[model samples]
Target: MLSRARLIQRLVIFAIFSFLLFVGSQRIPLRSNTVPSAPSAPSPARDSSYERQVQFWKNLHNLLESNSPATDPPERLKKAENVLFDPNANYTRPDLFAISEGDVKQLQQVHQRVVQKIKNDNSSLELVYHRGKRGIVSAAGRKYLPTLVISLRLLRRSGTRFPVEVFIASQEQYDEVVCEQILPTMNAVCIVLSGILGTNVVSRLEPFQLKSFAMLFSSFEQLLWLDASCFPIHDAIEIFQSKPFTHVGLVTWPDFWSSDPSRFFNTIASKPEPPVSERASTDGGQLLISKKTHAKTLLLASYYNYYGETHFYLLLSQSDVGGSDKETYLAAASVLDEPFYAVNEPIRSIGHRNANGHLDSSATVQYSPTEDYKLTNQGINHVKDANAGPIPHAFFLRTSYSKMSPVNLFDPSRNGSEEVSPIRGPDGKPSRAWTAEKETIDSLGGPDVEREYWSHVRWTVCTLEGLQFKDWKDKEGTCQQAKEYFDAVFAPKDRR
Candidate 1:
């Protein structure tokens, strides 16, 4: 026990120590600055593959930088430089860049912390959270929405006695799914990969604006690849057994014919088509690959791309060669000579770049002049198990389209499925049947559906959509969690 004045001094010192301890408990990870890599970092700018994002970022850098920001010009340029100029910049051909509002700061900090933490200790804890501006933890801010409809549809379509996995890749379309709704789905694993990265202090949060297809390869390699655009009309495993087109398939979209394919494409292009690999151009949106083969090539390419090495270790097909993972994919395809199926014409769905093009909505509805899409006796009705024999039932393939019009504010247009091939139903009969898809307005409560979807998806699009995040590997982070979440709520805790 000291005297009064000395006691007061000690009290002040103790208060300072307590304050420092509080600050220590609230320590923010360097990776939370909204850049590439690191948990809880505000997502990324491209849900597209890594190679796609590389070029996307470069072109974006030119376009966005030239156009300049409405707010800050020089500072933005400096920030852009911070994004564009990597001392270890992989000046590899065609790799582009896409920087959203928050990526610059976040990735920078994350990089620093990872290095610092490594230096400070032999072992360290993961730093995946951010002290969000609004005082909400990263996990708490999310008020999950419902993925019931999609989950049920996919389950019915997949024909699984049990739940199945489905990855969700949207252009920031639905936030609740990313933030809330999708979190609860069981059996369906929504790989929330986006291609953009950004920070929004406004929401007292940082949001990612995905811009590329980079992470698609990541998920595909990890066996989390499922085309989100595909509606579950039938068995999903049937589709899976057929050789999965890991990248873009040979299928063509109405938006590609005679148009500059470069617009939305970071697609691999080998003119006259690589001989032996019977294929045409395709969209990365609905592609697939074998976990055993194609995914290996994709992973090899992704690793090289991430390392900034010019030549990738993997080999793809001849015609499927070019862009980021282009050469590697083409070489791989060539080696495999695996025939792939495309969801071409006749059956109709929205998502074509310009729906009214040569393969316009009307034309897709009426007929399919292109060979990529033809009526076939081939279709999938149910997911087959290892022991199940192939059934006579069939289905058709269709191109998915999105209606990007100003009139559809915070809304996406209704997608129609094409009547591709007329397949045989059970009992040795041909079936060209297709379910009537609900009108766009009725799909999920109207135009605001897009908004509702985006509310959760936008930020996720930037970070989770295409990044192939490690946490996403967990069950809770999957589309299947939807069911689990529901079960926990309605079912007994012990059962869950």
Candidate 2:
């Protein structure tokens, strides 16, 4: 219809118009067919949760910094300050720290109430233990309950006035059963914990959380925690009366393997320098805490427990040997610049009785001649020898050579009716029980003594269940040579 130049111009215009339409179509999202993109910003609930977590940690930091004791050394204060202010610090996991707005408010309220309670009751001291259920019906838990009962019985016998509190982490029905049946007999108060903190972590980490944040469940100003395995043979009240415990708020003992601090320190990523003192070894089985003196220490310990495995990957590894909690406690104490009193004299916590009648106790026990054996700066006597006084506060009785069945100790149906007794022979005679007269008679040279000694030695035979003890016939290479084999499997990578 038009000339050649006009036709060309018209076609070019149409092409440009089509291109413009295409660009417009691309810019405008299709409402019917297009999949909606996620919002760029976090939802209001998520935003609120994150802010609360941030605020929670910030408040905790402030609390630690402000409430730290005046006596705290400059190094410890500085460490606390650095950890609190560090922008990169993984203080808490957002999900675990605050599950919802309700959780956030509840945590704050509980924390405040606990703090207030501790402040109001400065003179009160309480003994607390934690028991976490292993299964719907826990066999190990049943064993532990009797152990706790024995310790409480000993404590009551020793005239301890402090109330015993048991923290049970189990189903509501199980808790009720324990409360109604077991706690009633023991005269102990039972508190059921929700155990929400660090629940996502491995099973072993649960102990760290339970022990580190023990104050959350405790209202007392001073708290003493005893492991279920520990048996208080004497009045533990004497321990609190001791100068070491009174002077220093936190007190612990050395581990059996207490050679190197570097082995433990290396397990922590921060790699805090161990204390210069000889008493740097950690035994967390027994701990005495003073709320006012060790509040910051407690917080630091809890923080380490929460973030320890993350910082030190070795803690999460198989070769850790369940020492991560102990390592974290020691590291936190060191960082806090707090003095943790380690009794110089061995506390006869773990005792082994051999067939020879000579007690292979922890290095701390000694023979005493006095009727009222005084507890000196040296550790308490665990073994009661001839002409020896009572062992003061002998906590642990380790019968590792012969494993006693839990069935012998606890009956869940009967609620632990079995009375505690010494290891007995087939003839019903106490195997390990020794009398001064018998020892004297043995020393006087008699054929009867020889027979009796041999009889005692025969009882030392290993009776540990599950593992078969086979004597190696090939005497050329001792099984002790397998130390390296075990070290490779169980030892930490750094140690190995």
Candidate 3:
């Protein structure tokens, strides 16, 4: 009805107003005239629990820093401030720092508080993860990727329906190809340690400390933790349903040595001297724990590992062989007065003979917990005389000498034998690592586990194009050697 210019202006104003209205509708309600909603009734409890968890970690950090500040070097290692072990050499007794009575008392006080809190707090376990999930967990660095790959392949081959979570220490260790491409195919996912614990806390940890932390931060309510080099021979899901595991909700295997704790540790834990029969050091190569049952135990174990380099490692181990984070698990459970079952079976060694006449044990085989439990109840096997009866079935095989990695399996021996590959025995003979394990493997009346292990290793090195293969100097030669060795030692004997 108006003139042309006026009508055009009116239409433009209408269009602008409509466009503005659409944009306004996309945003949240305007802050003005908006009343803030009150938190739900349950929010306060959850918030309190979260705050307590945060404070617990903070307290640990402060205590550790006060006693063994990373910035200050111990007098023993004048040349190296934060480094505990030599870069090129193996960890030795000299690498340990001395702890004082005062240090022990302070640690004890903190631990006492932790115990009391768990006793008082109903929300302790629930804060970690909601109940009703189970999974397997392992930790690996970039260097250990090959071992992890082989271990995981063997795990999947064992037909475990449980999911797997592989924890890496930092962002630097995460491989996009491995994490995103390879692991998901195997029903495993990579969890970066730093992402859950934060960098400040993770920076204080070492390889020995990673395992407990992995178990703590993993989302599973029931956790089966395996070392990167350890693999199960069969499905392990039934362990959760077994009487031993269900009764205590925690199970650990035994190392060969006695595990009498240092006198000081006994005093701190307020535990009596452990009986020789019940004191077999824990072989923590693999373990099962239910967070629903032992949340306090896991938290305390994490604390032990967090302060291990300075205090608990030596306290529990007392310079025993294979001591690192191994003993902390049992120690924590014991401290919490939680019932835990330690398998009543001997840990047996398996390996082919080396150049020397003596047997060079490579991997240690652990027994099935359910079988051990049955034998114990029947009085056929006792912790005091684990070897008195027939060995329980070999459930887990943990590699020590070589971890089925291309570098360790095919490369020149680090012992300065230029021609001797790790996979071979005397005279460069193509031999299985478990040549000495034949008697035990055959006695089980099962398919050759060693052969199955090698087949997986061959598949990993020869077939899979995953990033772990990048460690191989001569991928073709390595893969060929692995295949040839398998064909020679295992293939002809593959009865299955």
Candidate 4:
């Protein structure tokens, strides 16, 4: 009924409307039965490196576990012993066990005498220092001798009635200079284990093992095992009389700085659970063992050493210092579950060295005339802090100090002064001088009445012994200074 043009116009409008409707439908999203995708997970923050490290440690731990001596104790022990003591081995010493029947009879006589002495003095204490064949031949032996001399001299100076025994791996480790010249001079007994324990037993044990187990061979009731590096500054007999040593029959100072039992636990391959209440980790440098009372403890410590020897590589892997002896003792104490007294009081008896091997300054404390007496009760006077306090009764000069001559430490003429001013006085008066003369009799006297107290003695010993080493020398010309200082301080007035 419509005109043809109009009908065509209507068709065009209809087609346009249809196209608009289809676009609207496409834009409107339709609801579906399917769930919507989770908001794309924030690309998991990458931790590939951490994950890799975790995996690596896991693998390493597994490898160590597989090789543990627990798998086959007997075979491992035999193998380790053979490797350690084979006479054909370059490291083996045949002299360790070489002794004649006459020598045996003589050793027996000596043992009987020692036993008789022990019987007469049940409360007698003996100071023990052990040196292995290798240690004696190396620069370590040279360095240690001076410390031994210093320790024995200090003991004698302290008027300690107890005798000292210097135990050597063999007659070869015993230098005539030490046995004849040094020990006789100090009145110390030199016992060669080659005759006592025989080579088979002695050769398989490491120097540290010999040190820890020295109590087993001691005829005395109590043994104070001091590392060759340890120098007693105070009356060590005081330690024996202390409540911890007297009550527990075992006493050791904690690590100089750290108290984290977990850190100690990590150092042993066995990873024994730490003591529930044991906060401070023990130091082996100074240990007092009562042989009769803590017989079980000594046996336990020896057992740990045996296990450590069997798994030496694994234990070594866990060490930061390449020494596992301390960790082994710690592990033994943990497994024993018996409480041992730890001198948590700040004894400052241990001297720590910097990476450069010099004494750490911050670790040293300044002496206050009034405060020092109080501090001394806490064992603060044990180290001679430069410009701080007088020399302590005992100090642990890190083995690194052995690498350099002590004479290189300071210039006596340039650094020394006659009257050392106290950093602080009772009333905080600047005029008061810190008189070393007051403590000189207690301390090893030095060049001046001031800074040259025990440090001069330490330098003198080190310089004298260091003269033997090829690398360590008095390059600083401090040896002449030491001699002058010694003349002024220690030499008899007539001799000077």
Name the lDDT of candidate 2: 0.38
Residue range 369-479, candidate 3, lDDT tens digits: 988888878887644453567666778888873544555575555435533454677876666666666665564333467777778878777654434344443454666
In order of listing, the candidates' clash counts read 127, 0, 0, 6
Candidate 2 lDDT trough over 10 residues, lowest sum: 74-83
Give Cα-based local distance difference scores for all models: 0.29, 0.38, 0.68, 0.41
C-alpha root-mean-square deviation, each candidate = 19.3, 25.3, 10.5, 30.2
Superposition-based RMSD of candidate 4 using all C-alpha atoms, in angstroms: 30.2
Candidate 2: the clashing residue pairs are: none
* Candidate 1 lDDT, 1-496, residue by residue in tens: 7999999999999999999999999997663322223111123333324344344334333322232212211111111111121222333222223334463344334333322332343212111111121110111111111222332333343353333332223323234334333333433333333333222211221121121123322333222222232223344444433422333332212112111111101222122332221222333323334433333233222322332121221112112223233233333333234343443231233221122222223111211212222223343211212223232222222222132111111111111222221111233232212222334223323334323333332334323424443333332233232233233333444885
Model 2 CA deviation exceeding 4 Å by range: 1-143, 195-204, 263-272, 275-277, 307-320, 349-405, 408-430, 433-496
Candidate 3 weakest ten by summed lDDT: 35-44
Q: Which stretches of candidate 3 lie over 4 Å from their true place?
A: 1-104, 124-126, 321-323, 382-388, 401-403, 413-415, 418-422, 443-447, 463-476, 492-496
Q: Write the per-residue lDDT of candidate 4 for residues 1-496, one digit (tens) a residue.
A: 9999999999999999999999988895554423112100100012223233233324322332333333321111111111111112233111111234453344334323332333343222222222210011111143355556555555555455565666665544544455445555555655554444446656776776666444544445676666654444444566665555566666565453332222222333234444333333345566666754564455445544544554432332221222345544444444444445554333332132333444322111111122333454565533323344443332322222322224333342332322121221233222112232333322323223223334434554554554443323435455555555455545656895
How far is 387's C-alpha from truth in model 3 (Å)? 6.9
Better of 1 and 4 by TM-score: 4
Question: Can you give the TM-score per candidate against the true fold?
Answer: 0.32, 0.47, 0.77, 0.48
In candidate 2, how many Å is residue 121 off? 22
Score candidate 3 by lDDT.
Answer: 0.68
Candidate 4 off by > 4 Å? 1-143, 200-204, 257-272, 275-277, 309-319, 347-481, 484-496
Residue pairs in collision within model 4: 232-393, 233-393, 233-394, 234-393, 381-392, 382-392
